[model samples]
Target: MLTLTWRRGDGRCAFLAGMLALLCYISPASAEDGYDLWLRYAPVGSSKVEGYRSALGNVVAPDRTPTQRVVREELRRGLAGLLGSEPRFRASPAGDAALVLGTPASSPWLAPLRHELEGVGEEGYLLRWTRLDGRDALVIAAHRDIGVLYGVFHLLRLVQAGVSLDGLDVSEVPRIKLRLLNHWDNLDGYVERGYAGGSLWDWHTLPGWEDPRYTDYARANASLGINGTVLNNVNANALSFSPAYLRKAAALADVFRPYGVRVYLSARFSAPMELGGLATADPLDPDVRQWWREKAREIYALIPDFGGFLVKANSEGQPGPQDYGRTHADGANVLADALAPHGGVVMWRAFVYAHDVPEDRAKQAYNEFVGLDGAFRDNVVVQVKNGPIDFQPREPFHPLFGAMPRTPLMLEFQITKEYLGFATHLVYLGPLYEEVLRADTHARGAGSTVARVVDGSLESHALSGIAGVANIGDDRTWSGSHFDQANWYAFGRLAWNPYQSARDIAAEWVAMTFSPAQEVVRPVVDMMMASRETAVDYMTPLGLHHVIARGHHYGPGPWVDGGPRADWTSVYYHRADRDGIGFDRTASGSDAVSQYAADVAREFNDVERVPEPLLLWFHHVRWDRRLRSGRPLWDELVHRYTRGVRNVEAMQVTWRRLEGRVDAPRHRQVAAFLRIQRDEAQWWRDASVAYFQSINGLPLPAGEAPPPHPLAYYLSLQFPYAPGDGR
Candidate 1:
């Protein structure tokens, strides 16, 4: 049995007061170290302090797995900060009012609960306040050690979010079994679509020296129930497989292990030739299979729990089995076999397009993957990006979600703001994520949402996963701006529980990051909720997408054309002319809607039945075509673009009034960025309207603002050094 003790000024109450004092006024003191994140564990007032202390008298965590140790350390740290006293740890949970945490293997008391936890799976956990041996105690139980770690973090989150822990019967299992982050970071420190700064993984200084930031990074992800991270860009480098780089990755794996995060690598498909000196990297060849199996063994030897490969093969000129006239399933299954012995899975990316293929870019992924639906290995997951096209401001969910029900499909959402104005625009992607998640694929009838597909409930696949393209960088706030942090937060929360409402996630984030005070939280949550729609309205309202500047995608470029590939040009997507606009994906054209369920196909195929938000995405209407709004297509387009600009201007006003409510530095930074968003929103509206009006010869509607510059001026404007460009 273990004894428990609590000291005054040793818990969350003192820590909160300290942080409040530090951030009260803008000075050198206000510049935070940022290690706190949202888990400052700050001191509560005397009124609430005793309740927490009395409730949490001691800790008893017997599980000795690396992940369970992390949970124990976090509890100690959180209690120390919040209560201002370090709680005693007991060898067993025999004492009254003790906190018991473990898997069945570690805790005899939890052994009886194994049958109840059987449905929870390996990554699920249960937290309950129950009486044991005539004493009140808190029990955190799981089927596996990692789940116990997650349970601890969940409990801490509830406390930080100011929820009552009494009568807590929390049983949480991740909707998506594999929650991972895909970092588009290069070996040279440049991040693809990364706007914050250089990559967090400093390869030059790794293998021998480990940055404390790495641990904190793992901690943050663990807190959000994210369990894996792909440590390189999808445009992979072959040299990442070299022994030197492998050793560096092993070091990171060591740090991440305790936090329940397994490190994964984005593998270059030609690694057999580039790294192993094979003449031809054929999946069917004996030498190629042996090489991959050996490489997998080597990696597992270095880091026992390393997550497997994420491959972007035959996509955007990357090497793949297709290079040798082989199928995608053949390529993925080879690597999957290699890793299968070590209990690893392969995440094969479906973000494929080729200029040589004379088809709508949106239909390419579904065309390729659906053909080989059940051919993939059981351990292979097809990672499909949220939209068929690259992460645009607004796009219909990818058609592959329902098309390939036999294979496990993983949802790949971009947490990085590649199209929606990067980190500058105050767009909270929670609503955007929700929109896609809730979209009824109608594959398994009416209730078959995309979330169900991702969570493996709709198709009942053995393996399920979701990956977010991370936006984290070397910036002080982790993301470039402070509010952008909410996107990262929201991704983790959604990964944990796919059914959670975006509005609810936004409110929780606002209270944790800014203030728990209702007056301050309500306005901020409202702004965040409206932000994604505002960007869509101004930039690509009514399903218009990919109209940004060529290559950089910084501002509007509706006039862009004649790129190396027609698909790269903005004109290819919008297809505006004197007669009509929008890409024809109906029966008269690509017939991409046929890839979806029968009902969904009919709804999208018909011009009248298609939702107004996605009207232009599927159909091209004439300049004078009457919309549901009782306005012509041209006037409605202009109205939506103008309305988006006004919405951003309104956001600027709302942010300016929040000066004193938030810390001065962060407050000022958000205010300044909101100003940038407003200006850029206007630029988007002006450039798009001017270019479209030139093509259609339509007069501007009354009360709509004309372009600030001529069509030629907007077309000539160039952003050679824009951030997040692949180059």
Candidate 2:
């Protein structure tokens, strides 16, 4: 009904019309909902086109395997968009430029260079500019088809970033052995703590009807060099392992296999009794061992490269080997033995806590696993959360990073915005992750960081892995919000190389996701860099942890005291009184800092040496205690809270200036989300100020306004149906 017309010069219109008539294609730049994510291969600038256009006259791709086909198709799509014309396929390098894409086994040209690709391994590729038959060309060669696909994406990334393909010499191999994303997705499509929509796996229609989103999902993960994914929630159900569900998982696996991503399942440990007709699911029992072995066999039959079980045992209400008076190592070893014959690894979650409130809730996971360090099977990786307690806004490095040297340990981080204000708050988790990774664990020496421990550099272990609790769902944006996608991207980049800088990754994401223009990238990345600290300032400043509302964790609840388990309540952790505020993990209190290495323990215990950010986490300071800022403890807390709200306002101002510059849809969405963050940050500041003032009875300091409501008014507010609340 409507004819597309451009009021540009006639020459430009004629050229564009000719291109449209010839190719009949549309660039993904028109996609406003962010369905393309960072993979949007929009047209490059004239400079990039000039540098790369003559070098991409044809492609010499000889393979026709599924993965190879995928890489070829991606190149075609990307070249067409980025270069303004797709390259032609040539059997020989007859053109002046020919991009050769293949593994050694698939192409005669690459077979000679196979010796150079020796150390790159099965998933790493070698991308370089080389001469072919007296003509300059590019070569992307790897040991396997999947590796070629990764290189193809990397090539496209360079193009999107306006990087010249000339003189490109890159050889990339993932530093971590297994980069995994643990989806807290249930069978019924409900995602636990998922800020986005339902699970990507439509369980009802899966195994029969496959959604095109699945392919894009695989492509996105593969682009980041992520090799494995756990499909269901770690708080698992036995039904996920049933024959019907296994088929559905196999379907996802089939779609992912081409992209070199393996699908894993969170296994319910008590399935021997619940699914099988066994009275006792003891690890020592021959029948119990046989049941798991059969289950592993059945899973491998359907998914040949199936990743092993992700077990959450002896924690929460989930059943485990502990139910039969067995040790955690015993629980892990049984499954490890079953998966051993099939070349699988059992990822046993260490996010466990006793129902009984110990001297300190943070000390339980350390107490449980420290005794059995050398007892776990070689194939069993003890998956430890970054913090001892939970995925709080800030906490000291977990004591177990290098505590279990004899056992292969994997670092598990939550990418979901569970405590950082769900999906609404714009908290860039790169700095948060970097903080934990760079933390000196002091396990081996002063330089022993958590990153070294996870990458197996500290322990020199053969197996090393890292996991991120995924924030992905069925939303058109992939993540709930557009900027939230940056967190996902950051996690994958860090997972591939734990030592990579978060700010650098954020800048790259900004360039690819939004634009390469310096005007837009500079402020957006600055806002992202400050976002995590801003959230921490308002939500849990001065190292305060777990003060969020009970159950839902929706808003402020510093006064929460009574619950079934005292540890579950905010009052137990905060321990605010008329005299002082904050939990005292010092010698006079819980002495929880003593669990760390001697130097770390000393630093955490010393009030003066402890970092100001975590001061309240380790010490209970009096309201009148003067901080390094020369302000009283109460005044400093108020300053931080108000500063957080003001910082959000500053971010709003930064975003508002880019309205005409950024795409209308994305710019409008981010502006709206920034408003949410500003309001909620103020709520956090006011409600927290009100609650704490009731305790310390301190008046608002100079330049600070009193809260609009009393402590009771803030306390009376409830979010009964907040998104991502665990029902």
Candidate 3:
């Protein structure tokens, strides 16, 4: 019954009007282009609208601070779109079902609940359906304005999900200190291993003209509790450190500040020599350290609350301390010292290997960092990939995870489907992330999961963090495909609480993105749940890793060899010949198994004790070796390859049934993508079988057909212009 007695922010009203106009003109068939992402804020079904409309018809919120203004405007936008009517704003509670949102310091009525707010940290929030001033209301209270904003998003999510608002008492706190997105976008607007269209950061036009899309990007990330973003490629580009680009980055930082998202830059280690007029870029040199300190000061002056650097030093030809014969800890410590005064931290990467072949490429990172366990500064976190190897279709947990008890290691997951199927495949990475997070590292005693290590619960470290190599781009859907957005969403949710179920996350995303109807939600979530397994089955079945075609990594390449480094070739990894396939990391081979805890190492070394899923990862067996399935190793391998392609077929069939259920545009795009996936999966199965057959000289398993083409034919087929491929 109450209406706004005061004016809204002039800038906010204009922005909303323009955005609404844009939405009005979007064609129905283009709905799945994904510009709206999970924040579509579409109208709820008639059946559920009555109760929600009554309960949330009016809001009692004050817009004093920037964050507070964002919270109020978001409520207006979301409620108007979802409930099909603009909610009235009141200075005080006027109706029995009005909404109340504020920090304890701002609201005298919420002062008594300050004790309750104390439980949730600075980034957490509390939402309760309670009575205020004798009128029943849904109260969203937090310790900080940003927390209040997060609470607002949560309330809108409930409406979007068609869930009941009755007795809603929810409290959420982020388990990790830093939940960040590492964007591998370069200065030239191209992204490394990025399947999405183009870079989101338009540096040429930034610090002068602000794009409206930037605000939308911030909102989407904020809605999912993502708090930080490193805005350039890890492959160091010194040009990004120039004054002009700093201003550009500062412009982005300003847009993201109110949403609790801090901006960090991927500081190229050789920037001193490249941009600072210095000769030797050594961490041990005082002159080199001073140059970095001055650079840090300049960056902090431009963006006061700028999150610190993400360094991928001395790896893959990127300059680092190793060039100066210094350890990773030394490089990280110097930067950490400079940033310490500004309350910043350095994220030093641990995806290291000698350019020359070591005993095994997988052992290099663990060998390098484990020795300097406690040498790193307290503020320096070692950012490590989820798997020991590069972002393959499937890989075992990185050995460095539990090895560094003295240092905090942040889990870095690739959200982009570089090796998976690149924008065209319907692969959900939720299960992949879940698999890594839930894996038992057995570091301390029983329940020492990789999740515990990342959250700092295992080592009792105060600083904990997780980073996802962002799949976000300038594409209409944000990510290249409609489904890939789920990976970004899943990463944020898991980074907030590693223990959350991936299936549950997919369910929530399905309901909010497609429709709240159970008919739509159930089947879509079911497809997502099985997607990653399907990808692993088809692309790299039975513990296979990194066998994609050379250069672009486009297709099957089990026969690929003669690369500059042996580790870069598929033959080095698969080791397929008269013997069976798989890398042997057990004691007799690379001895990578010894990097893990005693119990884990023992299990990995014993082929019988190892899980069959990873049979090929840790052991190299003969073709005739018998598996627990009572089948020969070669037959089991073939069965897995066939199973993978069959799963893709099943997914295609499942998606086809939803022709009329989902929006025509997104539905059409997804259907097309599913078709592509099925074809590609068949290609992978056939190509892999053919290559292995040439080496093993064995007959195809029973009921298996010979590949349609010879190995030469498949090898000659090339994708010279793949989307994410480097020229």
Candidate 4:
């Protein structure tokens, strides 16, 4: 990976050392796919290489346990990749800078410092410099072997980020108890809303041939401290619960177990009827309850550490307890009861809306769930989407966040860009995730941010979690686009610490993925920080949402109507007309703002107090109404659409300037994708302006370009084979 030239008593070697030191972290310009994600431990420069080699020259970790075995292997792999040499394995600390790793039980040297491990908890670790056997060594101690594994990854990440390890005294404990990935992948290798290639799990060869890629997947997730993974689509198939498929899942569990990643499955609610020989699958039925109990026992028998199930019941034509005329609590309690014995959980989804469209679709989930606040079993966590509606480019925080304080609510975020130009458009989701997490719900009073609710700080609940819909696939890059990997990385970081700054996470990702040089990190992070808002400005600025094409949800479709359900159409959300634009959700229209806490409802109901970005979401205003920008609503909308397209143009220019600073293959791919994004941004702006202008009969603002063709030209576009829409 690196060339070294040594000359005995020669000045030529000194000259080469100076040049190498000046280069400081040479970018691995060789061709590389993003398969490595953020764990690419490229060789360091001459300046720091010697120090790192001395510090990590030997390992003193025990390999008796499975987790300990993996920890030793990971250190060997990481050290070899970064220092260009494999570290020596020693039974005891001997070198001046050996890495001593173990719990008090595993290594007797850590037993004396047991009191220092007070707040680190079971999964947390303590890393500090200490004297071992009268020699200077870095100690990575924890309460358990899994914590030791996490500590190893943490140390490797710091090395990759070029951090100094001299005074290393750090303690890390995950803020959320369940950091998980929900894969919307089906058994047939087709992904529902997946933008990457096929599903990661090849079902045909599983249970026997354990692919090495599965091990790599665990390594990547473990590096980020993500502990759990739900291994199938929420639109579940009952056959997955059959004996054949359960064995397949058990095989995967064994592979992930050593890396601290426990596998969970998306349970079909009607599995008793489909997989078992039961007549009815009612949650209240004694027969159905017993069936689930037996199923849980069967699962635990194969995979002792099975993480339990994620159920998406009674939504989007899926079966649930409602089909049996019961509440959601009734549906979830049965599964929770079964899994509680094995120390598992039931993550029941709250993305539900009735077949009969309500006055506001945004209010349905809050209304359905708020009534059953304290009714659910303790092992059941109600999973909620970040926004009230679907994962649009932008939307207000869901009102249900603070409503169900009595129940454990796990925040669910979609990492896949189903809405914001899937995989092609360079939209970093860190800003979007940060915005919603920072929004205050005022459940108790002030300082009641959504992040508090998710991390169980406000509610003081024992179980806390945050899940992201996985963007991973069988593609070589993992995520289809290299930049999309940032979303997955950011989600895991935020899950580890809810209050961390998203911009800081972006910088960390950039430094590890590309060159650690400020020249590359600064511009890439700046572009990422601004990319989300740029897409929102062009796609759904000023809180306009669900304005994408039907079914596929690819491009502009504000004219869409006549769907099976009104909630499925773009017209239902925006409700733009010649008289006025935007939905009226205040008391005058749907009264949907009433779902929030009294203070938040008041702010959302009043036109003057509401955040200007969400003005259209709450109150319908006339085109001539003035905005905070001192322009009329019509003019502001036009300005935002144009601004979005301009931002994409600027991004393209930014990427062009970073050509040689990044690897040639990845750089070329990003540039080509940015070009695609620029064209699509133009399409979104032109198509939206043309359609809305036809309703209001307004002339174009000065210097704004008109649509290239008539409105029909934009409307005539069709995408029968869009990548993610597996249906």
Candidate 5:
């Protein structure tokens, strides 16, 4: 209900408005394009404006450091936008309601609370309502400048979410140490698996032309507490380390430094051979080792606080130590030894699969890593994907989460909708992330959760982290679609605290991104909470994984086969036949379930005991096998696929109801995208049913509609120009 007003005192409001618009990337028109993301500080409702103004009327914070300067600017910009008035900036806490922000060293008044600050560590903050100058004051104090910035963002987030700041009390420290976004962006500005437009990093215009967009990118990541960003594709080019590109990276590092975001690169393991013309790129070779060591030094000299390398070696034809008859440890250690001198850690990816077929692709990473648990150097962290297989719509947590105790493991999640609808479907990944994190690994007794393993609590390891494959691009919306932006936001929030609720995160995102009204927030949150399951039901119900089309992964391709490798085809995963439709990973089959802890393995091994959602993942039962729904397996599968399509329809309806409540532009875009999702859901459902029925020859369930097209019709569909298919 609060309306915008111009302050007539000394023309400061006019000056402040221009500054806020420039800093926040505000456009001339009022229409939203989602560039601002959740940081858009629209004015609060009338009921809460007065309370927020009272709590944040005057700000007292230092600008001695770059981080401190950004904090003050952010507070000024955010407060002016949220309260519709520029709050007074004071040298010290004096007003009846003042917001004080600084570290104990910067603000002497905060020294008395040093004991309370002890638990916050170096990058944590403490916020509380206290009496200063015998008046009400809210202090955002930290042990470091970066923490103060994080605290300021947190306070602004609360304000944007329409929370009461009367008794504000918050103490937050990130559970994970290195929350990073891995950009699969090549030097040519092409993003692999990126549904958004071209890469955000215009490599052609870098170092000399530092895009203001780069600073905004850092701001968004800093708001989410993501402190690191891997700027290139995992399929790295050696030129990224070239002097020209390194200078380009250095410029980005300088821009991101103030926001506490350190730049990292996806280092090519064969860089010695490519860049330095070495005879052999073996990790054990003396020349190769020295080359990497010197390379690390050169990089650090250019960018002192560089966060080190993310290596993807020996996976999908990438060169690695394995090519020279060496192990993953050898490959990681050489880089780790080089970076250890500069206090940098190497994040070595564990997503490896051999050229020859294995018993099960899901079992490969665990088989490769579990044996070398303690072989890794102290500066090496094995980055494992959330699931053992590729980023399936629904997958059991990777077995290696608890298997490797000695070595620190970083959970890698794909924020891009690679397997989902790729920016077209409204699939909120918070629930998926939450499900994987909360999964009980049962490694050390009864309740060894994956979250504990990633946070280093279960193993008491010194290092812990999580990484997200970024969906960001040069598109105006940043993530190709408005809804896709939530995944990036959710990943950062979950990385900060893995134990938080997905529904709560969804609610917070809905409030910040859209309206905070219960009508808008409630339905939107409900849709988001159910979206992942809805996608699973239509795309790959009952633990069905990797059933998408051959190349671009667009539509259903249950009949797809005859690829270069059997594992690359859809048939290798689902394994549907006349008898059944599911992969059997039990003792009689591949025994992939055995990789898990005893308790988890036992449940997954038994079809009756395993969760029904994952029925097909472990057991290949008969077509007539009775499911929990009292219907046979085939009927239940059809029911689930149909149910998924219906749920998408329901979501379309839900979104339609918010036409006027939400902004016209975003609302129209979401509605169109939802229509596409609904249509695609139908396509996925019908095509899958058509293909499966050809194998099973089963009659359609009662009230179930038959596919309008035949299996061959669906099979003949081709997409030669699908987006994000760059190899």
Candidate 6:
């Protein structure tokens, strides 16, 4: 087990005492403290205040735009808390110790560096600690106010991370132009696939009284360089466009504006008839186009910087242009045209699957989208889910990543633990995000990574984006579990720079959110790093995906079948039979592997060459097939499941060692969750092995524990009202 010891007068003890004092003094009545997130610039202890005070002594912002005003205010607020004194605001960099914050247009002193900043783009910024007029100053220069806002957060992060500000020359430009957060929140408080409690936006309480949580939400997004948020669920409600609801959305837009976050709404394609009282909502109809134009004008009048509409048309029974014999592009173009004059873009989701059962579900998205390549308008972005299927615990990166070079594609990742054990499971999603981002698409060549496609580096598309379905809620800790917060943090960091490693991100987050002490940080990060794989091993190892209960996706359900739709059941995905186990995505069967690039298809198509991690996803091997590791396929599968359970047991041991390292409330919360995770892990291993072994006619390994109950009992388990199902 991991161990943590704190001696008197040591840094760990000092930091612990400081945290205790802050917790005692800080009243709970402040701004739904849950919303502030890491951006909370609460007072820091005296010992660490001197360096920040000396470095960031004064602020000099020249621009007076609303966004610029927000940048200035944030600097002042953050400095006051960290340095214990509000820095002086200067008109220019005339003072010896001033910090100049502005775009090149606002600050003439940065005119000479315009050449250097030319390639950085409108959203990029340059921060330097160079001398100005013989005075030591920090200059944050960008091409736009929003970029300056991002720079301010970056500067503050450096201070928080304890980096030396001297001789700094940091210039950063976002690879993706549109960094967005997709909330699966409905008009009602329910959030689909959301593990955290109900939605953060209290729709019942609106325009009249703006929640301070809204402002704090914006602050958190700004701190992570996330600039856009889609306010409603992809399974959209037309009522969001009602005049009353528009006012509520406008109120949120006002709060987020200061933090450089522009609000985007999920639009129901049939809103023309549902809300506008039109005879038809067809995209080809002239009246439908006119209705959208009028609606766009109405929405923009209330919120000028409105990012645009996120549409989930013709998927999962949602109405769309297809109902009227129009293509996906036809639906998006109509909306894009309406928002074009106002500089808005339509985010058209490519998560569509025909209601008709297909030979292979994984190939549906790629086939549909590849045909529509270059058919979309310049302002329309195709949003593709990280994996083709609904947020499974483990999935190969979607084939759509490299198939459509002409169309700008945005990655949609789920931060919520829909398939991974929900709020109670200690599954850190950093590695999951990294795995997808680092996947080699091989679209252009060997170097064609999914990160390049997402960031617009591969295709050179004008607009690029990466969005995470938020896990945020009314929970005091923001995310339901304390460690779950890292998923949110990891998503933002990856969205900003997809090249960042998950391990590094975890280390940084652990240091900031908890303690930076080596003993505490090291063990905590190790647990986090192993957490996701452990969940995968115990839940659905060897490329076996979507084996959860039918409705709530709670416990094991390998016997689950006969759902309203075949695709919704666990048996439909795994396809295990007495003959053998695993789906056949190879050419001999579904040929789903052909959807990938030529090289990827070649690798996946061959049984011998297919990666062991994805072996079951592509081919059905005999139970006794010999693995490269010399274990029979059945034995290896059981071993993986048992290893997963053991890993969770180890994590429990690791966490127990840190009893005094974290606060009593958070420590106990995590301990309780770990206990739940261990129980569930065992449940998963037993249930899965029991059901699969029944099909393969195999016995349990000599030392492995037999399943606790009969296969019927595990299959009979039910949870109709699980949270996040949005029933």
TM-score of each: 0.94, 0.95, 0.96, 0.95, 0.96, 0.93
Best by lDDT: 5
At residue 580, candidate 1 shows an lDDT of: 84
RMSD of each: 6.2, 4.7, 6.3, 6.1, 5.6, 6.5
Superposed by TM-score, candidate 5 places the C-alpha of residue 375 at a distance from the truth, in angstroms, of 0.5
Candidate 1 displacement at residue 518 in angstroms: 1.4
RMSD of 6: 6.5
Model 6 lowest lDDT segment of ten? 27-36
Q: Give one digit per residue, the lDDT tens place, for model 5 in 263-300.
A: 99999999999999999999999999999999999999
lDDT of 5 at 237: 96
Better of 5 and 6 by TM-score: 5
- How many clashing residue pairs appear in each of the predictions shown? 21, 0, 0, 0, 2, 0
Deviation from truth (RMSD, Å), model 1: 6.2
Query: What is candidate 4's CA lDDT for residue 58?
Result: 80
Cα lDDT tens digits, model 4, 1-727, are: 8867689778888888888776654444333678788888887766888898888888888999888999999999899988899988888775454789999999987887699887898889998898777887898999989889989988988888788999999998988999999999999999988989999999999898999999999999888889999999999999888889999999999999988899999999999998888999999999999999999999999989999899999898999999989999999999999999999999999999797888889999998999999999999999999999988888899999999989999999999999999999999999999999999999999889999999999999999999999999998889999999999999999999989999999999998898888998999999999999999999998889999998888998999999698988988988888988999999888999989889999999999999988988998989989899998999999999999999999998988999888888799899999999999999999999999999899988788889897899999999988888848
The digit string of per-residue lDDT tens for model 3 on 1-727 reads 9542334776667777777678777756565568999998989988988898888888888788999999988999998899898788888785454788898788776776899888899989999977677877788999999999988888898899988988888998989999999999988899888888889989889989989999998999899899999999988689889999999999999999999999999988888899988888999899989998999999999999999999998888889999989999999998998899999999999988796798788889998899999999999999999988998877889988898999999999999988999988989999999999999888987789999999999999999999999998888888989999999999998998999999999988998898888888888888899889888887787788889998888888888899688988988888877867788899998899999999989999999998877888888988999999899988887888888889888888888888888887888888988899889999999999888888899999989988999999998998888877654
* Model 1: per-residue Cα lDDT over 1-727, one tens digit each: 8643445776966776676677665454354434356776665545656677777767778746677777788888877766677778887666554688898888876777888798788889889987665677888899888888888877776665667777889888887889999999999999999988999999999988999999999999988899999999999999999999999999999999888899999999999999999999999999999999999999999989988999999978899999999999999999999999999999999998764845688889988899999999999999999988888888888899977889999999999999989889999999999999999999878988899999998888879999999999998789898888899999999998989999988887777677666777889999999999999999999988889888888998888789578899888999999998998899888898888899999999999999889888999888899999999999999999988999998888888888787877677778889999999998888888998888988789998878978888887788799998988
Instruction: Output the worst ten-in-a-row residue range by lDDT, candidate 1.
Output: 26-35
Compared with the true structure, what per-residue lDDT tens digits does model 6 show for residues 1-727?
9565779878899887787778776654333233345555555446667766766786778647888888888888888766678888877777455588886678877776678788778778999886677777788988888888889988877665566687899999887788899998988888888888888999888988888878878888887888999999999999999999999999999988877788999999999999989999999899999999999999999999999999998888999998989999999999999999999999999988787978778888888779999999999999999988878888988999999999999999989898888889999999999999999999999989999999888988878998999988878777888888889999998898999999988887776666656788899999999999999899988889989887888888878889578887888888888767789998899898888999999999998998888889888888889998898888989999999999999999998999887656667778998999999999999999999988889888778889989888886777777888857
Worst 10 residues of 2 by lDDT: 21-30
The better candidate by lDDT, 2 or 6, is: 2
